[model samples]
Target: MGRVTTEPSAYHRRMAEQKRSAIIDAATGLFLDSGYDGTSLARIAEAAGVSRATLFKQFPTKAALFDAIVTEYWKVEGEGGLDLRPGDLRAGLTAVGRRYVALLTRPRMVALFRIVIAEAPRFPELGQTQFKRGKMPYFTSVRRYLEAEHEAGTVRLDDPELATTQFLGMIADYVFWPRMLLVDWSPDEASMARAVDEAVLTIEARYATSSARPA
Candidate 1:
């Protein structure tokens, strides 16, 4: 039998990915605890058990690391996995609203929001990048779902984009904002259900066709 040898490049690539994951995990905790202005690459490297040179090789800057952390959070949090189903528009929208509220109101996500808000003035690009990468994709997906519903006669909206925005805003104002602004304020299941129900009802009343509405 011929001798087999593993490729050095493949081994290096796997190690790099493992290191990146570790770095992101450490950075997420540090960023959540200390906020963006308070976290440094040295601290993250030490916490991640990597050298500063290795951390720099992966992220290059604090903002870049923050961006990676936000992206990783969303990926693990299932923000990219929301999909509009074929039946029961109201149920689908309600589920989406509830999940979105849950994600935004979670402690870690609220901490991320605080970090972004606090550091946005100093690192404006961080805010922009978070919106472009983290927030906009979900919003765009919702808008597209609404548009499909409208075209399918499931909803009757003059503007699907505006209607989608309004639907999200309803939940955000009712559930997310309070939790974000008040550390002591956490919505119980009843409150979350009520908010999501109201948001679904409002959207259905305004946009869903009579046949598409829940009985």
Candidate 2:
């Protein structure tokens, strides 16, 4: 068959994505200001400037909207996935680490986390939803990257999950976890860069196979 014409569908898809983003942004702000329990879909639709019918069509329930907010917030840019070469352990992880830092440092991301922390007690499912739907995908990507590196003979990791924990935890403890407690816990670019570099070196030291080791 000849090349298919996709112009109309692509235009429609772009419009749908734009509307979805608006809905998510409106709902996220409302959830932060009003708490998940206090915010309603009608208000979110009005704030987003979309029709209530449209909002309902996109997100039929408040929980679903919250889930979308959580999932969409954590999604990495680009293809929203790790696109690392299989064997270049250091370079790949440096990219991943920088991406993680970028994710953590976004203002809306911090606010989103704060919203989850503040509202989670009364609305425990929000916490579960954030962890399950938002956080785990990113976590799993790192773990799977480690696993792939091992398979590619780039690293020798028996416990990819633990390795993932160690790698991400090191950087998060320095750059992210502190911000959760200290409102003014922003690290300088040099310091965050050092954190990522050091984490990569540590993982490489522990896990790089003999042939993968530096000459």
What Cα-based lDDT does every candidate model obtain? 0.80, 0.89
Q: Look at candidate 2 and tell me the lDDT of residue 100.
A: 92
* True-vs-predicted CA distance for residue 127, candidate 1, Å: 1.1
My TM-score estimates for the predictions, one after another, are 0.82, 0.88
Q: Report per-prediction Cα RMSD to one decimal.
A: 3.3, 3.1
By TM-score, the best candidate is 2
Tens digits of per-residue lDDT for model 2, 1-215: 89987567877889989999999999889988998888999999999999999999999999998898888878899974796768788889999999999888876887788898998889899899989998799999988888899999999887899999999999988988888778888889999999999999999899898888778
Model 2 ranges with Cα > 4 A deviation = 1-11
**Candidate 2, 170: how far from true, in Å?**
1.0
Q: Which candidate is the best by lDDT?
A: 2
- lDDT digits (tens) for residues 67-146 of candidate 1: 88677655524544776664578877977887777667654777677777877898898789789877787788788878
Q: Candidate 1, 186: how far from true, in Å? A: 0.9
